[model samples]
Target: MAQIDTIIASPSPVECRRLQNILEKEPDFRILAQARDLSQTYTATEALSPAIVLISQSFAALPEFEVMHMLFRVLDTRWLVIENGDACTPHLKITRNSDLFTIDLRSGGAGLVPLIRSVTRAQRRKMVPARPVRQSMPGQKKLVMIGASTGGVDALATLLSGFPTDCPPTMIVQHTRHSFGGSLIGLLDRQCAAHVMPAKDRMRLDPGTICIAAGGRAHMQLAISHAPQVRLVPSAPVSGHLPSVDAMFHSALRVAPRTVAVLLTGMGRDGARGMLELRQAGASTLAQDEASSVVYGMPKAAWENGGAQKRIPLVDMAAEILKAASMSGEEAKP
Candidate 1:
């Protein structure tokens, strides 16, 4: 297991205790330091070199932008800003301007755990390699498969919104708790002009539509029946995940060998081997760049394994996918 160095900042003792309790639950995480003031937080992060910093809006007297700028400039650590209460604070609102930090209210602490875990998992998965892939053939309809977990809701929203309505038939495996799956789909549908739906078993690939895997009962798979279609399988978790990215990518490669497989911001290497298979099958592959990834695990693993042909930022991924798919004549029209 990989260890995470962490820093916590909160002006109040109660808030500090809450964050401390949360960190204590994760064995792989170590508290490098804690601070209640802006100056102290900046000093501690720079000296400790923590990978992530958890900060509350009430922390210190400094303005939120100053604190955020300092953290980014000094440590380059990922920041998770916890709002003080139900009402959005001015600092919290300002924090949202930067893509580097994730903002959430303290009332949503239950959701925070999963996001932290996802980042931790991503860090661990980044160390893995994607080896033993086959090369792609030229001029084939290229399928692009993507997977994300934890802070993936916002990350996916940011990445997918850039996609045009005519973007290639893209499939996504996003890790969300059961009840939130539909809401997740709804969010994406509203954000992107592209059609987004919960993937159903045996639904044929249609241009300009995005299929997202639903949680709970069914696992999404790519099935070949006359032609390739999204198939929902009732099966146990593979790689500790259902609607596994690996499963989707593996099936996509089998159905369309010369596809593009992308492993985006997520925790764990669920799609590492599948990405390798796609590479071996002569498919173009990409990983999300580390700087832009909330957690760089999945993409890093794919890159290390020699599976990724390119590593791009989240903002640019849709365009890159379109470019790659166009080479295979599967380009969606504008």
Candidate 2:
């Protein structure tokens, strides 16, 4: 098997040697060169172009996030950062249940290799094309808002499976990493009958179709132009997140008179405030019960904050949403 080439960039010689010794033991990893500064690291990277660049936070000089953006955009290099055992300086922040990804030098090199492999696989998976939404005619214009995070993928699959083929137009914001949005759309498309796709700016929300919030490049929002359309607006992270659940929920309030908001499993309180606003606007709202939620943070927050009017389980969530929109019955229930 081919070894994964790497460049170690650390300010301290001791740390560099330690990392080199540890990673060298792994047959799959091959250290090409070591650099003491960003300049040397950049030169070595341009020349060696290794698969992975392992750098220490201190040697990075600039802010960690700035360095990350610069490397990702300018060099297009896949790199991992070591925070020097500082829990406050997070190494990785992305989608999925775990908000942060870190590697502890104390644990030796055992966990390091596996985590890199997982990230590499995910990067590869992100390149796969998402299944396109099959075009269909518009249905009842009533809208449905869904917010989820953490173990939301499976829960969403179960709830969406119960959606009728002609279910109301739906907008979903599931906290996820950038490139992972396409993969999530493909996953849900397979598990459910709805025509699911990544929401594009100004894309109309037709009936029987589901628009999902994307990451990385743009954040998804709602607007009423020619029709209820998805808006991909460029904006900084809100509540520490792009395509924030609160953003969507607040927008739904503008159409609350004909909207049904559903809050699912997630971490944090991103959607709680929006749900509360929706409740105040006289919109029908549902939150997944704690027993059915993965983290129960967002839903629990909404329920406690008096934003959720009905607490439903994953199995019953779809039925409740459909019923609230007057789409329930033998023909509409899945």
Candidate 3:
């Protein structure tokens, strides 16, 4: 068996020592580091990218804990939460998909050892690639631009579900914290037929690839190059968002005629003005109708303000997208 790298993060020195002692007994498990606070945990995780993090439940009380927690989920690390409370509590969650295991520290070595074994096994399985997948990115004259927020995650999953494996290059800006991008990519990748991944600076836009504009300090914009590429602009937040929807749509003004810009369910007016700009530039712009939207704020604004050419229901959105993208003629009106 290969050695598994693990970290212990806890506020209590006694708990840290206890975990250290337990981890040290297992030759196959290596204690890469120990963190006494949230700051150290974040730093160590980023630096080491450990296989497991034996984190205490108290660590959740630290400042900036929510931000760091979202960031940590992006990494391929299993969280073994050492809850000092009830082991038989109905709230205990130990699920493979969640990559989380909860155990009461009071239960002693019995619970911890079994959980470590289970987590390590799961980690090893995750490390093994089922198969290699390489998407052949061919440049298509057309592309799709999507801006969503609020209820964007489920909405995106539904929208991308209709995309074929070789659909046109698609880029999206979903209002989210910088650290939540990876988690979103992972969730969408599992549900979508097309290859989904985070957008990188200067990466070419090609068919069969879906670039998600999120994470980090920069906003994702279309590169001003001969061949269209993704450009990450390290600038201030626009429209109250770091990866603003308006920033992405405005960047594609030159190619708006060939782009299908859609504004989906969101709480704010971030993408409304940009969608209007694209519509005026001859892009096929559509906003999700109030009937299908969870909040109906962004799409409603777009439609009411004439930014979107039409108000489309979520169910009909996939078919409309396919029709619009495949049509060859004057801008296909939604």
The whole-model lDDT of each prediction reads 0.69, 0.72, 0.75
Q: Can you give the lDDT of residue 307 in candidate 2?
A: 90
Tens-digit lDDT track of model 1 for 1-334: 6777788888778877888887788888888888977657766775777778887756522232343343443334666777676555443443344534455544547777667656545432221221213232233256668887644666677777766665667788887556557756764676576678888877877666789984656678877677668888888887788878887877776655447778887778888888888777767788889988766788888888887878898888877776777674233221
Q: What is candidate 2's CA lDDT for residue 24?
A: 74
Q: Per-candidate TM vs. native?
A: 0.58, 0.58, 0.61
Per-residue accuracy of model 2 over 1-334 as CA lDDT, tens digit each: 6667789888889778888887877888888999987657766776776667787766442322332333332334567776577444222332123222445576665578877666555332223232334333234446899988776776777788777667788999888666456656755775566778888778888778898884545567789877899888778877767888888888877778677889998788988999889878767788999887757889999989999987898889987787777632222322
What residue pairs are clashing in model 2? none
TM-score of 1: 0.58
Task: Indicate which candidate wins on lDDT.
Answer: 3
Off by over 4 Å in 1: 1-140, 329-334
**Candidate 2 TM-score versus the reference:** 0.58
Estimate the lDDT of model 1.
0.69
